[model samples]
Target: MTSPSGAPGPGGPDPRRPSLAWLLLPGLGLLVLAAISVSLGAGDFSFSGLLAGTASESWTLLVASRVPRTLALLLAGMSLAVAGLIMQMLVRNRYVEPSTAGTTESATLGILCLMLLAPDTPVIGKMLAATAFAMAGTLLFLGILRRVPLRSPFLVPLIGLVLGGVVHAVTTFFAYRHDMLQSLYAWTTGDFSGVLRGRYELLWIGFGLACAAYLAADRYTVAGMGQQFTTNLGLNHRRLTLMGLLIVSAIASVVVVTAGNIPFLGLIVPNAVSLVLGDNMRRSVPWVALLGGSFVLACDVLGRLVHPPYEIPIGTVVGIVGSALFLLLILRRKGANA
Candidate 1:
């Protein structure tokens, strides 16, 4: 038998040591990117001056805008990735992710509703509404999964795509009718350009949710096993599943609200981490979170640097890069199954 963390059950490698890299490469990469994001912006600044902590308007821009943006990117990226990994594990499928599962779309709809209903609602109130509705959507999907027999692990992803499409259509309908299509566009095409000291506080929700995820890591792994098996081990599978869903919803909503929708982040980062680090949730969690944070920060940096006066949105870079990787995975799976 294998443990949920992808370890050999009884004779597995020592759980005390990380099964993968000597040093967490992904985390190291994230740190490097964070530094770069903090140092570079739309201003003319010397790299040496930044290192020396020189004081200037450019330095202030770097400090105020770029630094907070980098932090938000890291927090949102890590939370979403971890949430996606947990969703896949709980459902026993590799391709299940928050965006595909209709959770993000639902949250977006919630945001749109808030905008329409109470245009002056506080950001926290909007976030709470989004999270609540997003959690409901996740629970609905889980219920649907209970009724449907999964033909293959891959089939579940197809279902999610269809579900997301349906929700997107509904969201679009409301958005277009309310003459808020452009507003919704702004939400879908994520940009870190708006990140500043006061506005970026929403991202802290992701950080707090990540902490909750870490605390529940062991329980989620236990619940990943079949319900009966978990029951035999004296674990409450239902409670764990609900708890995982709550965490997922909170993280997903916060990411969507803060950074717009970043697809495949939840899927690709975790899959890559699992391939290298194995499935041990605890061991994989840190590296996975780091990889996600690093990947998004790098993409955000690319978006900023690639376009000088005008910046590309972070979601665009992620979509382009992540889609390519996702297609490769699909092709590889086809080859193996063929």
Candidate 2:
């Protein structure tokens, strides 16, 4: 149940929920990390130089590439984490995420369609197409849940995993037939090296979606409670469900378009925060956003530095970490149930 403040509180306010103090504490750490990230690669980047504005090359890298990349990380992190939270609430299951629930595959199909039909289309048009496919894909997953007898919570994600596999198969088949398989792989492989000024603007849509989520946080929690419950409380539950779908699909498409299948950011970030902070959507969204951004930013920096001058993809690092966490979560879940 929720506390008087509507935050999840079995007894009282969740201590793990960030206050201004908590925000400041991590905010400072993230700031320090972000500074380091911005200054690391191929430029005369230092605090003094940044402040004095003396280095033109440094300033250009800061403004054109590094700054945009960082912003993309922040937006992708925040949006995808919140998207995971929303999917969990909507399904009332902890395991569903854009990656798991066929959302990514659906969005990728949309992207593939755009590539075939209108390679010259603007990015926004591509985003719209992908968002539409993602919405349909997510809806299909939910439809599966509705039609089947799912007795175990674990079954929810298991089905989602299977669903994602099927979707991926389709994406692969079509991409191969079209002889665009290489382009497809590069597009969705989740690297940030290409995120210069002009390439990454689609991520702004994710930022805007994140803000919308914050505004309607309470509605999500209500919708999560189930259909009859929300309806009795005077909400159109279906409408809100569709709204959640739209938001989830929108952010997923935007992130995929701009950042390229940043695997497990959605799955790992929200689940990690939820373990500490509980399921208080209103209170927890900000924490999710902040910590998710910080985590992705750190991973991006690590990717850049691990090979130095050369680089690993941000998705590769996140995939390695997230896959470990995924196994751990499954084991912990089993132990708890046992």
Clashes of each: 2, 0
- Highest-lDDT candidate: 2
lDDT per residue as tens, model 1, 286-316:
8778888988998888888886778889899
TM-score of 1: 0.91
**What TM-score against the true fold does each predicted structure earn?**
0.91, 0.92
Q: How much is 151 displaced in model 1, in angstroms?
A: 1.3
Tens-place lDDT per residue, model 2, 1-338, is 33221222334445554467865876787787777777777656665776787877677778898888888888888888888888888888777789889898899999999999999998899899999999999999999989988777778878888998998888999999999998788757888888888888788788788889889989888887778888989999998889888999999999888878877777778777777677778877887888888988888899988878888888899889888888897787667666
> What is the number of residue pairs that collide in model 1?
2
The weakest ten consecutive residues by lDDT in model 2 span 1-10
